[model samples]
Target: MTSIAHSAAVSAALRDGKPVVALESTIITHGMPWPQNVETARKVEAAVRAGGAEPATIAVLDGVIHAGLEDSQLEAMGKATGFLKLSRADLGYAVATRKNGSTTVAATMIAADRAGIRVFATGGIGGVHRGVEKTYDISADLQELARTPVCVVCAGAKAILDLPKTLETLETLGVPVVGYGSDEFPAFWSRRSGLAAPMRLDDPADIAALIRARAELRLDGGVLVGNPIPLADEIAANEINPAIEAAVDEADAMGISGKALTPFLLSRMLDLTQGRSLIANIALVENNARLAAKIAAAL
Candidate 1:
């Protein structure tokens, strides 16, 4: 049987009690074009290292689960085609089949927990789709957060999702949504989601303290740290909402649903927004990576 983690650096760091931040790999395989995807991956990893932690970019390659990827491995994955977009339901199947796979938020949480990592960073999380009431298409990311013992730092749930429903579901699951250094929840490309966060933590140490408290209380779930995108890079909610709505409507009209829906919406939004959305995405992810590194160090 293949073990949980195959990265020697990650294994050694875990054994040595060093700070390590878990990273998802779908950003490389499904989030962007080749060279840019590889470049962004390297930048995010560098940001984590600059903030005083090791970056474990999780992926599954030919049946082995890698907790950290080398630059060559990242380049290969970025250029490769037909990699599985793995979530909780299919992660095991991909491993068993000896296939190449990119880890989504849920899959990354599962791998991070198994590797004993306490913090993860990503661009944004998947959530309830806009018409989820009819489609019943909630992302497995929410359920993973309800049980995984890791702190996830992100801009927020993707703006393409139903932010209100996602927040409500997180509350129902007892997952704490902490807005880092901000009062309003972030809306992926926008700095504000126009919704209040369930909680707020101003410092990395305080967030780490909260995680420790959760452990003390024997809580089995993770926390969501909503770090807003940099003000300079954000496309204010008012400016971005129309584009998002149009993309959602287009997806619905074309019968785009399930895992295919998010990518489709994002692609349309990128075009509608003149590629600004992708730039904002890169900035926010790097910011989250830095904060996650700090939290992991404090832990």
Candidate 2:
């Protein structure tokens, strides 16, 4: 394992026992356009701070795995071109090759675990894609959740996925999918997925208690806390589902697979929704960051 390069703030927070939240870098790299990406990253970090915790945005830069980035580093990354979209399989290679890369949810989990960060915030998790029986395409995020001991706070699995199967697979993997303040699992841009969440907790302290119990019981993995997007920001399921289906169908037609599939689908969805999806995505990510900060504080 590579030794992580920690920002001074992150190192101090860990030493002083202050709450700190881990944030994924792929959102800055793959999920949005340049200026907005950096702007949103700042906003998400601000949200985390407002909730009483410092945020550690994880990324790999020039052969070093950075557990947290400084502002100059974030700006450089946002403006740079051509970086690897790293997951569990490619993280070490990107570092060994002295290349830059953005951390996906799975990759972020690995970095957070290495740095001793216990919570992460992201837009949404990748999961079993639609029509996966043929592709057998399950996201490394799910597998990471089954083993990494970092609490992941997100809206839920990306709405472009097969939610039911994602939920089933999580259950089978022994990953607790906890709905924060709701019974239904959140669907990224939408408030509800129409699927009952396997577990529910309304308070951050209660969620923290669950995490602590898992540690005491020697459970190996983290919990997925589904924090719904604000009602005013949500694109209703009825309004968003068609756009999602069209995006998926288009990806199939274009033969976009693996890492390329998500960016492709998200870009298509943005076009189909006339950029409403991007707005919702920003809202949900900030919301998750706030919630994750609270959870980290609780811990």
Candidate 3:
């Protein structure tokens, strides 16, 4: 009666008790241009493999939620058009309607949890958008993090959002935000946000212990591991903030809102930063995938 589907690799990994890291597929279908998107996805998977875990790139294909995807399936989805960008709100609806879709952070967590996978890796998570007081456009990723038990590894909240408010919101929701090796929380492409992380734990084994302790204490929500982007690839906050601000102003001027806002802003930032943003993005995601695999293996 279970409606979920799993690729042979994932199912076998689960059966054999091997570590597996869940990857969000929106990174393929919506995060970038076709060829680069597929290419980055492959590289991310390779990073996870190199880190000693199987990678389960989660997505919904023709309305069926799949925990892992075949290479051919990934190829087709990367170039496919009109796929739903699914999050907590739309993931179930997409499945019921049999729609082709890419999973966001929240959707991936939901799928990964249902498949009994505990860890997920992603580029960045959505947060309180700039000017959220006027539009109240907080991302479902935050609330889903509060509800799901999966651990999500990311650089941090998207640099395009209001970091202070996003951090405050996570605190209010009782979600753990752990900085991997730094006191300051990361800001997506930047290594430091200038804001203190709620907690800091440097080693992956310590992080795995914290996750196990959560289970022992019967905690209900997820932990966010803020793994900073590698130093060589980072665009310092001073340099990236201006591009993000310019992109936000442009998005507001264009009246872009809801799901349309993120992709538009990201695309605009890529242009404003002369493609450095995208390069940093690819770097951070691969780094997160690498760390997530280690954490999963530890767990």
Candidate 4:
């Protein structure tokens, strides 16, 4: 197997046995616009550090798999155009071609596992799209969760996805989904997705214990920690549901398919919501990062 190189700061943190939380880079490259994207990335990293863990934001740049990035790199990536949104299928391709790419949930899990980081924080996980019956579209994240041992913390699957189907798919894959502090699974921009979670965990210590137990049992898959957005920051299901439906409908009408669908829908939602969606996204990501840092510290 090829050895993965960690950044100098990440290597030092790993060597010193400090808590380290893995983060994905797509949110910096493809998820948002410039300035705010870089700003939010820094704030999320700060949140992790405040909760006593080192943040390692993973990405592939110029054929090198970076476990963490410097401020300049983060800024440049946020402003750069034409970066690929990488998953398991194309992560190697991006590296092989020496292209700059942002890590998706699946790619991040793979990188985090290799780096021996047990926890990752992200805004949301991709899942079954609403029209998957015809498009057969599903995110690689579900399969990655089934195989990788790195616990992932997210608000939930993106609100635009088919929540019940996503949950069912995760169940079928034998991946544990734990709703943090609530019985209801959270939607990305909203506090609740109207579906009951398979399990609920109210404490960070208990979450850490669950992860340790899973490792002890030699489980192959990771755990899903569904942390809801703060009520103050949430957009409410009713208000956002219509916007999401309109975005999906527009994508279908335009014949947008495959990997392009997500970014397209998200971009539409950002405009339709007058940028409120982006605000909620940043808040939930920060919330997940803080919780993930605590769990990483405990582990």
Of 1 and 3, the candidate ahead on TM-score is 3
Question: 296, model 1: CA deviation in Å?
Answer: 0.4
Q: Which lDDT tens digits does candidate 2 get at residues 226-259?
A: 9999999999999999999998999899888999
lDDT of the structure predicted as candidate 4: 0.94
> After superposing candidate 1, which stretches have Cα over 4 Å from the reference?
none
Which portions of model 2 miss their true places by more than 4 Å?
none
Q: 1-299, model 4: which lDDT tens digit per residue?
A: 64677878889889999999999999998888888999999999999999999999999888788898899999899989989899999988988899989999999999999988889999999999998899899999999999999999999999999999999999999999999999999999999888999999999999999999999999999999999999999999999999999999999999998889888998999999999999999999999999999999889
Q: How close is candidate 1 to the true structure, as a TM-score?
A: 0.98
lDDT of 3 by residue, 169-198 (tens): 999999999999999999999999999999
CA lDDT of every candidate:
0.93, 0.94, 0.93, 0.94
Count of clashes, each model: 0, 0, 0, 0
Please write out the lDDT profile of model 1 over residues 1-299, one tens digit for every residue: 55786478877888899999999999998888768789999999999999989999999999788899988999999999999999999999998889999999999999998888999999999999888879999999999999999899999999999999999999999999999999988999999988998898999999999999999999988999999999999999999999999999999999999878887888798799999988998999999999999999999
Superposed by TM-score, candidate 1 places the C-alpha of residue 86 at a distance from the truth, in angstroms, of 0.7
Question: In candidate 3, how many Å is residue 158 off?
Answer: 0.3
Model 3 residue 258 distance off true place after TM-score fit, in angstroms: 0.2
The TM-score measured for candidate 3 stands at: 0.99
Work out the TM-score per prediction.
Answer: 0.98, 0.99, 0.99, 0.99
- Lowest lDDT 10-residue stretch of candidate 1: 1-10
Model 2, residue 241: what's the lDDT? Answer: 96
